[model samples]
Target: MDLNLESLGFTKEELQERVIARICTQLLDGVGYDEDDNEFTTASQFHRQMRTSIKEKIEATINAIAEREVLPNVASYIENLTLQETNRWGEKTGEKVTFIEYLTRRAEAYMQEKVNFDGKSKEENGNGYSWSGTQTRITHLVHQHLHYSIENAMKDAMKIANSAIATGIQETVKTKLAEISTTLKVGVTSK
Candidate 1:
């Protein structure tokens, strides 16, 4: 069935976004680690722990999407929406790509480019040698999910807002078309 997102209390954008966010959050949370006894837990240590946890979550989450049967369908849906948004934004969104592809590209880029350290790389930093770059890309993915979820929720809200609008538009068009058809029928009879 062709489901119009608006009819079901969601916009196509909103539903997609909600799904993205939930998936990302769950994935990121999957990467968390527990502290060992006698480890000095400072505010910095907690922040570091959370950051690493989030990164693990994002990595596992995106990686798992590739193995799912729905990946193709989900990718197609996201691709279409990206195109639509690009059109709305009045700029070419550039080469069409799937969500899985996008995730892979971003993850790779994050690992090579962003996940560097001043004194050492992420692996070394995580071992307690020095501070490393925040896995901002992972954070970004989570943020993207949040935006999507909120949009989905908003779209759901809009379903009620446009209830009368949709009904009025449908009825008005139907009446006008019927009147024209009757007029044509009468004209034919006269001839």
Candidate 2:
């Protein structure tokens, strides 16, 4: 009454072993053969981690560029003006004035009140002031320069991040593949 499994090319026990081996291999490789025998790959933890890391890095880079290129220029412009002789004479004789403080106050007043060439106040134009005549030309040039600087910095940061991420991923994949290959070789040799 014993079953002759060998006549079926593989014994029942051998068939079970083969199935278990295939499952173990699929688990290690992170891919499984589907009902159609097509390979389906799963997302690895490393890939998820890389995506999160890249998003954080990009946000930090944008913040850093804005802080470095935009804030200081505005601050410097507020700190460098000297009081005109007419304004100086109009001040009370004994009043001692801090030049930086004075200039900052005056700059703030100008920004709040100044109209652009189009006759729109700074606040009305979304924090952009329009100056008249030569001053208008100068302001436009400065605005253009600042805009270009910030835009260029962002573009450069993106380019650098993309290159770094590409290189990092490539190197990581190569290292992982080498490790897997070495492990497979050792396992085969040991058995």
Candidate 3:
């Protein structure tokens, strides 16, 4: 079919060059594949490029789908919580608590539970690392505050004891002096 090339914006010379390339070296004895070796080379290059492009696109699509669909499920599973809200004593309370509220209750319980400072008990029963907000831990507050208070209290106790002892000694001395004066007066009268 003699089709005009001007309609397709192509020149006759360009079409002739393609035709000449196709006519080389291939004898179609029984459907010979290569007109030239360039076809196979071009196909191999196209196959590599197509495989790379498809693999990248497929991986990107899978990642996007996972982010959209699976991540929320994973997050929900991690936060697995009761449908109804409960108080510290496991009784049904007002409204349902969210995950943050649940965690806060747990944190409060952990902090409120009397922290045993007994080193022996800790050595006997300790497990994994313990964590607490520094402000919540009494150990931190006590050490920071009461450590100096103990020394001050001891000093006050010692001062009170010393004052009591001094008062007792003064009273005893006065009593003894009064008894001696009375004995001298009695002896002087007898003389």
Candidate 4:
């Protein structure tokens, strides 16, 4: 079934997030870690120096996934829209070519096109729009998923850290101390 993102009270962007956390959690699943401590307790730390490299890898992965898996499907969907619109306009079959391959080529041409404004007329001007840099915009759009993924991963890590801290406090620190004021979320529900 064709799902309209806008009609679902959200964009692909809203769903784009949590990808990192979801992937990380899935990847971390079945990982050989300490059995005594929960997943949240024993956390792995990343070095700050590896930030750029890791981000670049994540971006590359995201782009690869988008281009290979997502783009074709999106293109096909757009082709349907294009065909429907063309049929609605009742134009000649060859006039409007938006069938995947042709559409992609046309889009790439537009994307790479550059304009020469220092011209007298359309005949003299070069064929490029000033705002036709699709690389940055497209990359930004696709790369956004990675950015959100990293953020979500960080958030997930933070939650895990907090959980570990609370559990540690309750079990280890709280036990040693006769009285404790820490509000552990352990089995505690808001009233």
Candidate 5:
């Protein structure tokens, strides 16, 4: 499937920038003190530091998703598909060809103009080996499955990131308001 991110009113780059900005703002808002135990004095300085931290975090998240989610999902799908195809071939041919050999042979035939299997040429195999029918169906199924998996993975990542930012913002706001209320109470008592 062709994914036109622009249809969502933002390009990938724009989405990345927005996410970075939002996460940085939330992180900066949560910052109560510096290394010297002094409260953050400058919004600009806090934002700069938060931007760097958020960028590193975004990179880490990307790496984690690629390693933990996308790769594993694709590998699992490929494995299952290969097994299904092997079983189908076995049932059709009534030959006990090893799965690995079957895959290798299929790959080789795909690279050639004509597919020859079980001593039968493409013509002898009817339209089974043609690119229009079975081959097209298998290709379409794999494409659709992979596309859905990847889209879901991306949505999950975005949801997690957004949730973290929102939580940080809420916590920061509560802490700052409590501090202000305490300061006001002390001033009133002193007067």
Candidate 6:
């Protein structure tokens, strides 16, 4: 079912579209995908690719919903989501914060603002961390990308990118389709 933002106090449609487009685009860019690839050249061919993406996103979203919305015991490490938590020693105050909470705040910050397309932050973009026209969140994205290498003792980042993009597409499509379904069912009743 389509989630109703109106019920949640969001009244703008274009903003919603922009949010969707932005997130989807970010997810697409995160995993090293190119929307202009010639492999999906024709309209129908492109649509088929989109369908595949939608299916993958659906499965991811369903899995997420089931795990998050139903079962609370499972860990909240979303495959498509990039979470970054950190702990640092203070110079003098000696205060500390947990890494998990820090990462959650980062994710929250991302959701509250528009991510630049350069893939790097305003601080790191100019330092060559990423190229132009790439989405922001490069740090977390790259961290996740590199995790597989560290976890499995590999040296490649492409595999992680591919998996992230695949999962992101799957989750995004599923969430959007569910929202649409809810909207379509507003007045319908089973007889």
- Which prediction has the highest lDDT against the true structure? 2
**Candidate 1's TM-score:** 0.22
Taking the tens digit of each residue's C-alpha lDDT, what string does model 5 give over 92-139? Answer: 434555556678878765544332323334565676645222243345
Q: What is the lDDT of residue 167 in candidate 3?
A: 99
lDDT of 3 by residue, 32-140 (tens): 2464543433335545566677779999999999999988698686576645767899998777766767788878766555544432123234652563222334465
**Best-fitting candidate, scored by TM-score:** 4
Q: Each candidate: what lDDT?
A: 0.65, 0.69, 0.65, 0.58, 0.67, 0.61
Q: Is candidate 3 or candidate 6 better by TM-score?
A: 3
Kindly provide the TM-score of model 6 when superposed on the true structure, using C-alpha atoms. 0.17
Worst 10 residues of 4 by lDDT: 115-124
Q: Give the per-residue lDDT of model 1 (tens digit) for 102-142.
A: 77777786645444324234555576455566555455556
Model 6 residue runs over 4 Å out of place are 1-90, 110-114, 127-191
* Alpha-carbon deviation at 22 in model 5, angstroms: 97
| Candidate 4 residue-wise lDDT, 122-143, digit = tens | 2234443443333433454446
What stretches of model 3 exceed 4 Å from their correct place?
1-52, 65-96, 118-124, 127-191
What does candidate 6's lDDT look like per residue over 1-191, in tens digits? 56876766677986778778755654443322256632322334555676679889999999999877767743544323443334475234433445566677668777444335534455545654444433436554665677756867553566888899999999999999999998885576798
**TM-score preference between candidates 2 and 3, better one:** 3
Task: Report RMSD (Å) for each prediction in the order shown.
Answer: 35.7, 39.4, 19.5, 36.4, 37.6, 40.0
Regarding TM-score, does 4 or 6 come out ahead? Answer: 4
Which residue pairs of candidate 5 clash? none
Q: What is the TM-score of candidate 3?
A: 0.27
| Residue range with the least summed lDDT across 10 consecutive positions in model 1 | 32-41
